[model samples]
Target: MEFNIPGIVNAAIPTRQDRNRNVMIISSNSGGSYNDSGFLSSDFPHSPAKLYITAESDSFDAQTLRDWRDEGFNVEYLPLGDGGSAYAARLESLAKSNNLGPCQSYGIIAYGDAASFCLEHFHVVDNNPEFKLGCLVAYYPARIPDPRGKFPSPVRAIVHLAAKGEDSIDVVGHSQMLGIQGSRRVSRRRLDRGVGAGRALDMAYPAYRYDAEPGFAEHDLDEYDRVSAELAWSRSLAVVRRALMGYMDADASVVDQNTDGKFVTRNLSQTMGTYTAHRSPHVTYMPTLTGAIDSQELQRFYSEYFLNKNPPSTELTLVSRTVGSDRVVDELHVSFKHTQEMPWILPGLPPTNKRVEVMVVSIVTLKAGKICHEHVYWDQASVLMQVGLLDPKMIPQKASERGVKKLPIVGREAARRVLQGFEDEEDGEADNELIPGWYDDEEEEEEKDEQEGKKENTGKKTKLQEEKGKQPEKASVGPETRDEDGQAETIPERAKSEPKEVEA
Candidate 1:
């Protein structure tokens, strides 16, 4: 009989958004698309926040906007012609838009010069309660507000600064300078109350400093750093989520369903159904660079090279599992016999019929209750050693000359040690076996002490025998003789058996 999982085999329908929170993205760039911004529309496609792009002109990359809409966001573009009264009036009108309820508020995300303007005029929202401003995020603004001044209650704010230049704000009356290498120096001034002052007062709001230049978080910019951009994205998302109360808990059951389809059930369609339908999902087996990106590629890889390629005796034991807000991390001990050709772990290698054991860590990130990406990691050297593909003793000549005899890779013992540790068993394996002369000094001292004790006991026995006038018994020699089958050799005379004395 065949059975299908509810959320795994079918995507969940989105709930209606009657009171969705609003977010305004203000860009300083005059005539560019949403792609020019540091944020990706696809990232927040299924978010419970309504996104609005306020720019100088309504002209934007049409394809980019369409992509955002396809991702399930009600995105709109509003034009802010000139600055001064007209811009403020337009913003005020948005604050009074019928889309927002009496209890709802909106957030602002500004960049460059527009960020500076928002920071300078943040008081407009603070003084007016009807503006209903929730939070403000500024990225690489030309100027920043005084660090000691705090924003009013119920309004959260954060700043992301570029590490390539100086800021207008001063710390403890000293100018704040941001170095190209992301070095920060602050001079603290002692207050009259014996209190240390500087960062403590300057931390009126959360400020993040990135080691990259301006536009590092933007995907389309030349200065974009994926690492920095990702870090910033997480922080920004956290702030927005907290302020707007827009938290989405990822469903861990979807991951379990995917795992069952891949390893146990060996069903391709069910495995593909566990991934997000809103965007392209990906999986990466970091050891062999296997797996694929997007639904089509992933389906092909799983069907041909992964799902059915495992040995029938495969076993997986979960070592540890960590459930986070949007991801799950699992440490697993996997064991299987190399009974057939397995392409995911050992590609293009014939079956050696060897039992292999290794530890694998998988990180699965989910979006909208579906898997977005998965990254699996394991020790490849240990796998190769267990499979007989790698010999530790076969090292380069240079390594031999350096007194290195064998590589430090262990076969199944690596997995055994982890399992032992997980089970809280007494450690049976010794450590640092690869280090030369690890036990040389202790073993040599033990042998030397044993030899000295034997000598002392022999001397004591000889002294006692002499003092007591007692001679030790003479050593006896046994005859070396063999009896033939059905016959016995004649015994030699007793006198002939004694040794004859010679006249030396």
Candidate 2:
């Protein structure tokens, strides 16, 4: 922080542009001051894009520079010892003055204090319509904090990749940055759900904790790096690069996290990357990731990121909760010491005495990486505790007189549900049912309108004719295969068939 970061940026000579567009990359993470070329050569977003990167490290005339030149981007290097602010201001002036290809872009990516280097220019980029400021991808962004407990900047349409676990601990020093309910955040690996590598990054996860059943029938996640894949180093890079590209252009869509084999229409963010367009009890709505967001929409995103608070806004409501992960072989072998939620009342087993740890770990095995065969090892009890569903003492409870202070604190909005058995237990529902991709409210409305239009086109068919009509000719339809929750999704828009009476 003592160095003139911008000053370092100022000294780098602009590379000659064969193409008009350019990407400006700044490498400065709390890990240590690195140079314009900080990430390892193999890191996904490292090269391939033609642009300039200024980092906090000592840049040597080496192969990386050669490799960058090979890719067509003009390479520039700067040392942090320069005039920080003046340097940064000058760089900003230079970037503003530079022109990219018609589709070319301007960007600044940071992992350390260097991430702050671009904050001053976010609003500036937003105003310049011609020069599309592509996505600002920040990894473990540091130093900036808001009084309301969220990221400080108004990141308009920027795709954020926040790596949890290093809240206060920087590269060398123990500087406190973000907090949780007035307390400085600390790294508790047992509680962290991080991969086996102790120093790896851990995402805060979603409202529904990921549960991977412990048998080989499920995936063996040796590295839970949060790439939506299991040990998929290459796939992780692919997705990160895709996001970086989308941030630069006007239209870019995130790959479907569930399956890379196919693509969905939705442009994705982190929360939506996993939950896009899926229908289910857990995710209530699909908020638009592309529109201009107001303060309220920003709040909803923050709440989902912070405490998982949802609703009361035009933006999609998310019942946010962390998605759990464990990639190391021995990392998750340790038992759950305590899941932090104070006794939360699960719907079915309200009055029971089953204080438990959540292990619906099946959901933990995402698709951006390899997936193990699950749907078989999912256990109800293990999942209940992980989600703070059935408290230990309340699994099968009666009116045991525990002091009010001793009881678990479930908020006032909820009136207590007395003990009851599972709602879909005997009826047969998977623990975490994969909400079908076709089940969004918006889709339903669109379907309804389409159906009404079809009815008008065909004119009125009688009740029997409509009910027992010939199969409405449609495309080659398929049956429901297993979805995320191991349940069959109700096929949307399946063509109807008629009943032909057979001779007795």
Model 1 residue 501 CA deviation (Å) reads 32
Score every model by TM-score.
0.65, 0.26
What does candidate 2's lDDT look like per residue over 1-504, in tens digits?
355443443244233221222222212122312222222343434333434444445553344344334323444544433536665555556445664433334444332344434432342222233333433433323332221122211122221223343323221112232311122222322223434443332331110112221110112233233332233222222232332333111111221232221112222244333431211112111111211133344335333332221111212111122332211111111112222321211322333322232212112222222222112122334344344453534622343542222233231101111111134343433222224443577779999999999989786655555666643434446777744323235566655565443332
| Residue 399 lDDT, candidate 1, scale 0-100 | 92
**Alpha-carbon runs more than 4 Å astray in model 1:** 1-48, 51-81, 89-95, 98-103, 123-131, 148-151, 164-204, 220-224, 246-249, 322-327, 367-369, 425-430, 435-504
Residue 242 lDDT (model 1): 50
Error of 2 at 190 (Å): 24
Please report the TM-score between candidate 1 and the true structure: 0.65
Q: Candidate 2: global Cα-lDDT?
A: 0.31
lDDT: worst 10-residue window of model 1: 16-25
Candidate 2: Cα lDDT at 343: 22
Candidate closest to the true structure, highest lDDT: 1
Residues 213-324, model 1: lDDT tens digits: 8777655568877666656655665565555544423358998899899999999888999998877899999988988999999999999999989999899988888876
